[model samples]
Target: MKESLYKRIARELAQQISTGTYPPGSLFPTEMELCEIWQVSRHTMREALRELTEQGLISRRKGAGTRVCEPPTSGVNHPLSHLEDLLLLAKNNLRVIKKIDEIVADIELSQLIDCPPGSRWLHIASIREDAQNPDAPICWTDSYASTDYARLRTFIRDDPHSLISDLIETHYGIKSHEVHQTITAVGVPKKIAKILNVEPDSPGMRIVRRYRDRDGKVFETTISIHPAGRYTCSIVLKSQNSGE
Candidate 1:
């Protein structure tokens, strides 16, 4: 789809502002001048200018025209690029093993992890804490790995890079090439809240990730809980409908 006149004007102005064409603390063109320059109606000009105002690039006043402000801070924001990025981030945290169990995937479990009902698997309970401060918990993860790789228990305790998918590739040569993730916000559960050191019923982020190999077989699934403000996930999306 083609860009709208207002969006095109807004983007052009934003680019100019970012490039210092319209320097900070400088006065912007009057509404009438902008309308004449863009050959657009007053409504279109006002809408385009509104975009810059909302983005904190320009301010409007009764006496003073729109004045440019300093650009917003660009730090403290990160995106989850892909499985590799997520796996790399795991190395920065410490996973303390809680216990391991063998279980049958009942109806609830099958639906939760998209696994075959009644199938047996290994359930590993662990808490990931910030390496900088062990007392500051990051998340509690309940992981299910294919029972065939149960022998990995020996290395999981001592290995610094002990992500289940990483262990599978190391031990079985089945490299995971993709990850499917789902995030939800919910009230903290009793078991997870205790592990994360937060009060019961506190707001939390529940993340479920399935690691799959080249053939799309999900060999590892992890359900993790992070207390409010402890962990965050970010994503950057491209405009799919744009004629790129």
Candidate 2:
């Protein structure tokens, strides 16, 4: 298989933007310049720009041309990176409420939390609502915590707005040494769709996160399913001295 010329151009340009070759708040090369450099038609250049824009890399204005976007404060970059950027992008315009319960873990969940099958655990379910329309649901999240850390129950219950890692530090004196996140696309389950106000088979993004403490203890695991149009993620890599 071969990459199309326009896609190749788009990928190369995206890389440049990600690598700081095109720093934030800086103008990108003009479309005519890109056309000349890539030796492509005007439409091809425009298509490449469109691809970059879709990835949240740059913004274009009719009179001002295209400028590289600043990494979003609420996205994968800033101090609150783990918390999704709910303000800038429409996809994340939702509020979440947490519900706590106790449950016995099944095999799949047991493996995720490093517990034996059928282990008792505290489960927290979070429902997300569209900010614009309170009636619209956008995401559903479920988190499992080891029963040994019963002290965390109060922390989780009290701080709905705090990041889980932050809560762990505040209450348990356990600081997260590393965080692992995985994302996949799946069809919404009927139960979740009913809450999200979408068809049962609607597409969605599923994010699974595993939190580890300083001593390598797995403290929490969370799974979040977001409606197709209601969430997105971005990663920004900067050179050590780039000061981004």
Candidate 3:
């Protein structure tokens, strides 16, 4: 699911703390200033600040401004938020294709992918694994792309980490301008439970993503699943006014 606005703000702030943008013992920007900077209501800003305090990263005073108490003890983990981090991860992880087949999007698939019903898409299944230890699986992903991109699937056989967007960019001169993702907790389905090595209905994470070009046209969609205890996504929130 999309993170709550306050939670997203909190994560940004936490990230700044972890990165030393707002060093320990420093006073954070005022709540009103933060509200204006982030374009959020005061209530929302307070909630975000409250989260920082509860996490032991900040301290709140009645009259004085909020202060950074300490840096985060642990660094956030993958799936990463920054492009640099993603490229780094791709270098350390490998994508292995399992299946690639054409499928007409039904009502359910249409809703899940934000695509038109009856549209043709190539459904591709793959597993991303740690390069050093192939047995250590990162996650199982089901990717969808327009049938126009089907020929790329043939090329993927040779280059396992070949991404659909890259192929589209390479062959068709189209580039993904934006990528949106939603992460949520869910129960492992029977179909993929065996692949994930988790019991049916076991706790898992569902990450849905859509890739769009400059014209705001979506050309790719992906749904990735991972067992909860085995994988996690990390995030850091920053205060808007400080630009930390």
lDDT digits (tens) for residues 1-244 of candidate 1: 1246776687678667756789989999999999998899999999888766755668999897789887434311113544544543465567888999898999998888889899999999988876544665778888998889888777688785558778778778888777889999988898767767889889988889988888998998999887777765666455878997
Model 1 alpha-carbon drift over 4 Å, by segment: 1-78, 240-244
> What's the count of clashing pairs in each model shown?
0, 1, 8
Models ranked on TM-score? 1, 3, 2
| Candidate 2 deviant stretches above 4 angstroms | 1-98, 238-244
For 1-244, candidate 3 gives per-residue lDDT tens digits of 2257887787677767655789899999899998998999999999888767766678989888789886433322443543323333344456788888999999999999998899889899988875434554667899998888768777667666646567677777777777888888999888878776668888888989898888999888889887765555655566778955
- Candidate 2 lDDT over residue span 100-218, tens digit each: 77899889878766778887877878775554456656568887777666766676556555555566666667676666778889999897787778899788888787878768777
Question: Is 1 or 2 the stronger prediction by lDDT?
Answer: 1
What TM-score against the true fold does each predicted structure earn? Answer: 0.66, 0.59, 0.64
lDDT of each: 0.76, 0.69, 0.74
Comparing 1 and 2 on TM-score, the stronger one: 1
Q: Model 1: clashing residue pairs?
A: none
Our model 1 lands, by Cα RMSD against the true structure, at 12.1
* Residue range with the least summed lDDT across 10 consecutive positions in model 2: 78-87
